[model samples]
Target: MLKQIGNYLKSKWSVRLMTIFYLIAGFNHFINPDFYLPLIPPFFNSHEKINVLSGITEIVLGIGILFYPSRKYASYGIMIMLLAFIPSHVYFIQINSCIDGGLCVPEWAGWFRLVIIHPALLLWAWEAGKSSS
Candidate 1:
């Protein structure tokens, strides 16, 4: 069973799954604006516009990744997007609470996301991009 799972991970299906995941996430940005608006730091102007733009970008990249010719470009875009989000994650930690009065977790949970989950997410994108066949 492990070998089968490993084989799937090594296949293009993994990339497709990643793309789908992002597409859904991006779509949610529009579907649930309130959820994302709180995530934007106060320093940035036009939070709503920024959220819209990011959502559109994610949709574009996610769709671009599905095509063979654009796969590499989309993967690169995804990587860049992920990297760009680091500051937001930091901001989340700095605030030490859920943005927009959402559910608040302990500071350690925020730190764990920054220190662990974020890197793992980046690595997942990197590996998918690098291993594209």
Candidate 2:
């Protein structure tokens, strides 16, 4: 099963699908800024600007990962971006996984995102970097 997963990740279609995923996700930051705004921790000022910047970064890196030459570095950039988001995830957990007037979910669900989904995304990005290289 692990080998099958690896083979799937290494496929060109997987990379393309990842490309589309990030592109849409990045644009969603703009289309639904309110959704992300509440998720931003209070320590960060100018939430609007931060949201724009994050969106732009995601869009740029998403585009960059589509090309063979830039795939590795772009993937690295994505990894860094994900790392930068750790604080927000921690804050979510700290706040009992509920954002007032924002996202509200079970605490365990938040932990699952931080512990499981996040790492899975990292692995996917890493494999994207290696695929077709």
Candidate 3:
């Protein structure tokens, strides 16, 4: 079972899943603005506009990744986007893993996400862009 799962992850289906995941997550930024707004750091200007721009970029890149011609570029874009998001994650940690009126999690979980999950997410995006087939 583990080997099968591993094999599947290396297949094109993994990329498809990543694309769909981003698409839904991106759309959620618009559908539920409240969850995302608090994530933007206080130092950034025009929180609402930044949120909108982020959503649009995610949607565009997510869609762009599906095509053979654009997959590499889109993956790179996703990596860049993830890099751009480091500050937000850091801000989440600074706020003690609990945003006032927004997402709240165990303190360690925030660090775990920043240290572990973020890199894994980047790797996933990188893998999705590769022509492994």
Candidate 4:
């Protein structure tokens, strides 16, 4: 039920799992830079540098979340990071193509990410912060 799921979200293990998810995602930013490059909106002056910095930021936030005392702060950082990526999501919808091509999905998926998935992630980070705090 929803109540049970809510309770689970507040649990410490959930925090740890989410922490690991961030860590892996951050690492992937470096491991698979090519996948991210095309997604960068053309307005940005330095796509490569921005991508690396974002990866580093994620890595640090992941480390922060791994520790109990820093979890709340890290959760907030995660929420902010998610917010920061909103424009890229918008760009994806505008472009209507996969970042590097080959895995193209319908434009609806792009809109879905912005309208639904992004908010869900924000809520997830908010819950994580509240519970960890």
Candidate of highest lDDT: 2
Where model 2 places Cα greater than 4 Å from the true spot, the runs are none
Model 2 clash number: 0
Q: Rank the candidates by TM-score, best first.
A: 2, 3, 4, 1
lDDT of 1 by residue, 59-99 (tens): 99888777777777777888898888877788888887565
Give the range where candidate 3 is weakest over 10 consecutive residues by summed lDDT. 2-11
103-123: candidate 3 lDDT, tens digit per residue:
899999999999999998887
- Model 1: residues with Cα > 4 Å off, grouped in runs: 1-10
Error of 3 at 126 (Å): 1.0
Find the candidate with the highest TM-score and give its number. Answer: 2
**Residues 1-133, candidate 2, lDDT per residue (tens digit)?**
9878877876888888888988998999999999888788899999999899899999999898889999999899989999988888988899999877888999999999999999988988888898884
Error of 1 at 99 (Å): 3.0
Worst 10 residues of 1 by lDDT: 2-11
Q: Which stretches of candidate 3 lie over 4 Å from their true place?
A: 1-10
Which model, 3 or 4, shows the larger lDDT? 3
Off by over 4 Å in 4: 1-3, 100-103
Rank list by lDDT: 2, 3, 4, 1
